[model samples]
Every structure is written in C-alpha cells, then in structure tokens.
Target: MTTTTEPTARPRTHKRVPAAPNRARKNPTRKRGPGSYAVIAAVTVFVLAFLSPFAIILVNSFKTGADYRANGSLSLPEQWNWSVIGDVWERVEFTQKLINSIQISLGVVLIAVVLALFNAYAIGIGRVRWRTAFLVFFLGVNVLPQEGLVYPIYYLFKEMGLYDGKLGYTILVGITYSAFGTYLLSSVFSSFPKELIEAASLDGAGRWTILWRIVLPMSWPTLSVMCVFFFVWSWNEFLYPLVLLISNDNQTVPLGLSVLQGQYSSDPTSMSAAALLGVIPMIVFFLIFQRSLTRGLTAGAVK
Candidate 1:
C-alpha cells in the first residue's frame, strides 16, 4: 500500500513537439534572371512603338499647321490650340457623325448578336445535321475578302434600295458580322453541358425556352464580348460606308475622318485633330466593355 502511494505521487513529464518552419519566410524575395529583364524591356519597347502613332496624333492636334509642318508631327506644339478641336468638329459635323456611328454600331450589334444566337442555337445546341459543313461555310465567309464582294454587295444593296441609308448599311454589316459571331458562339455552345440541356428537356422545356432561360443566361459573358467586337468592327468600317453612303447625312465617324484629307495636300493639324477625335469614341467604348471582354476571354480557361 505504501509503495503504490509513493508511485502515485510522481508527476508525469511530456515531450514537446517542434513547430513547422514557414516556407514563405525562408525565401521571401524571388530572383528574376536576365531573361525576365529582357522580356520586360521588349514589352516596354513594343508598347511604346504601338502607342507612338496615337502620341503623334495627340501632339499634332494641339499644334498649328505651320508648327506641325515646320517642327514635324513628333514635335511638341508651340501653342496649345484648343480651338482646333472645335473647328474640326464643326467642319466635319462630328456630332452627326458620332450619332450615326452610335446608331449603326448599336443596330449592327443587335442584329449580329440575335442572328448569331439563332444560328449558334441551331448548329450547336440543336445538333443539326451538316453542322460541321455549316461551320466550315461560316469560316469560309470570314476568310472571303470584302474587297472581292464589294461590287456584288454594292449592286445587291442598290437593287434592294438599301444602299445609301444607315438602315441598309447597318443590316449589311450586321449580317456580315454575324458570320464570324455565329462561328465563335457555335464553338462555345457545342461544348455546353449536355446534362443541363437534357434536364431542361426532361422538365418539358422547349428549344426556345431552354435557349432564353438556360443557354442565354449562362452565355452572357461570351455574348457581351461578341457585342463589343461587333460594335467596334461596325464603328471602324470604312470600305462599305465609303462605297454605300453617298450622302453626308448618312456617314459614320471613319468616313467623316476621311473628309479631312485631300488627294495631295491636307492640313496635318486638322487631320490629326479629327483622327484623335475619331479614336476617342472607340477608346470610350472599349473602356466601357473592358470588364466583359476580360471575362469572356478567360471563360474558356476557367472551364
């Protein structure tokens, strides 16, 4: 009894466990090699090269004709002439051109997106026969040069009485743009989750209902990106607008910018001003849809 009581009086000693070392703290700074620096330098140079034209346009826009001609487009303006923008604006009736551009771009985007959705739905989700052939046809349409079709399109539109007006041009551009949009969206839709489509079908959802409710909702990011691209493409269209639009009232911004140039000699400053102005709207549009574009681009990678 006395031995048992003495054994019970002894206190137990515990062994301590070592804590894990933080891998992050061991190597806080990452060492970049010469290749990294070279890549960075190369990217910087490319960016500067790409932006140089815009820089020249901006610098010359604020310069006088004499200053631009004498000191060159690369030189800084002798005086900051804010009036040049206003003068160029009035000369080109830029407000009307801007409105025309907005209308055409919006209209084309709507038509192209709708047509693309319909076409993509038929080819992609519907699992139609000859879908591969249809995709190939669309791809061929994209590759077909606008230069080759200009005459035919001009004649066709003229015959249809849709040649000169914004409505006609918008429709033409929308249809042209839809080919590429359809090709892009068809590829995206082809890879859509079959389970969702099947489930919807099992629940008595029709094609139209399934498309609007399930497909379209899930495809917003891609659709938004397509809309942005269509708007930009339509806005920057010079060839069709130049060919079809004869009246000053129906001209877009790119066509308006062309008015600033002469066959031989033109006001460099004024031309630069107009060019700078022309770029602003595109820049604004890009800025507005920048987030959507990013999402659409990364959606494939995320999946």
Candidate 2:
C-alpha cells in the first residue's frame, strides 16, 4: 500500500498537439458556386444566336428558286440543282473574276502588310518624334467620312493623271488607305516585348534584319489577321474600283458581278448561282485563315 501511494505521487504532465492544416485556406477563391452554369448557358445561347444567320444563308444557297420562294428561306430545296451552279459558272466568267479578285486582294495584302509593318515599327519600337501626332492624323483620316475624301481623292487622282484603268488606282488605294492597318498592327507591335529587339541589337543584328527575322516571325498571328481583313476588304470593294476604273475590263469582280447580274436578270436561278460562285471563294479563304484569325484575336486580347 505504501509503494502504490509513492508511485501515484508524481502527476502526469499533458503535451499539446499542433492544429490540423486548413485545407480551405489553400485557395479560398476557388470555391464552387451556383452562377457558373448560368454563365455557361448564356454563352451557349449567344453562340447559337450568332450562328443562325450563317446557317440560314447556307441553307438558302442550297435551295431551288421555286422552293425558296414557295417554302421560304428556312426550308431546304425540293431538288438541289447542281446544274444551275454550272450554268452560273459559265455565264459569270467565274474563273476570270475569281482570279482578278485574288490578284487584287493579294496586292492589297502585300501593300498593307509592308506599310503597316514600317508604320508600326516607327510608332511602337522606334517611338519616333511626333509619333502620337502622326498616329492621331492617321486615326482622323480613318474615322473621317469617306464622302469627304471621295471628291478630294477623285480630284487629286485626276490632277496627277492617275485616274482610269491605271494600276495607280490599286497602288494609291492600297497605300493611302493603309493607315487603318497601321493603327491596328501598331497595337499588336506595342504589346511585343522590347527586350527581344534590344537583345537582337546587342547580338549585332541590324534593324532590317531584326524586323524581318525576329519581329515578323513572332508577329505572324496579328499579321495573318490583318492580311485576311485587308484581302476581304479589297475583294469586296465596289465603290472605289467603280470610281477609279472607267473601262469595262478594268472593273474588279464586285463591279463586274453587278454587270453579270444584269445579264442574268431573267434567270433567278443563274443569279443565285452567280451569287454562290462569288461567295464560295471568300468562304474558302475564311475557312483557311479562321484559325489564324482566332489565334490573332486571342493573342492580342491576352497580351
């Protein structure tokens, strides 16, 4: 009994333990919520709404004129007249017009790209004196009503002996109207890391070399976007060509298509066919460059 009492005399001391790790504290903002599904649904609806117009156009393109007029644009053709497409091809000189459009569009793309590259470099990398002033001047021209320029441009071209069936029309249009492209490309150029240019210079690269090899390669996405836009604009341009070129053969596809429309006035089928022919190439071009366009937009946005 004495031994047991002696052993019990020493009291046991308790040791404290550290608290459990706070799992929720790791990333508190990542907690799931109810509104996410609503956002997803809204985006889905918006995309579908955007797609509906193109869907209608494509559907209508396939329809026969009678079927279209009778059943409406929403309905499919009772018979897909593949021959009508051929008929249109023969009458509209589709190949020639398409080639002409391609040539004009490509010319515009090349000229726009060249001018935009230089202007963007000057504004973005060089930061030349009065850069902002120059940029503002271009912006003013871009935003100003085309009606204001029409009379002046016409008068100037006439004065310079650059009017009517001259390649000058294409060149002048490409060069003078390039300010908008410059503004757009300048934004992308501004976003590029200046360190790349500095490093290139440090390695004994000339400005031209760096621009061609380093900057151009890295700037493909934005450049591709601008190219597509310029090409589309040039290809679709009607008024400018109409005003600039007086000769029938000098006319671009857009103007030529109007002529073709008159020639095929009695044939709605032929008109529809010609319309399809005119549009298909553009659709093809879009499909080809769509990835680049999307990539460019996303890159520009994120940067």
For all predictions, the C-alpha RMSD in Å is 3.5, 7.3
Model 2: residues with Cα > 4 Å off, grouped in runs: 1-75, 260-268, 300-303
How much lDDT does each candidate structure score? 0.91, 0.76
Per-prediction TM-score to the true structure, in the order listed = 0.91, 0.74
Cα lDDT tens digits for candidate 1, 68-168: 77888788888999999999999999999999999999999999999999999999989899999999999999999989999999999979988789999
Residue 180 CA displacement from its true place in model 1, Å: 0.7
Candidate 1: TM-score?
0.91
Number of clashing residue pairs in every model?
0, 0
What's the lDDT for residue 133 in model 1?
Answer: 96
Q: Considering every candidate listed, which one attains the maximal TM-score?
A: 1
- Among the numbered candidates, top lDDT falls to 1
Check candidate 1 and list the clashing pairs: none
Candidate 1 residue 278 C-alpha distance from true site, Å: 0.3
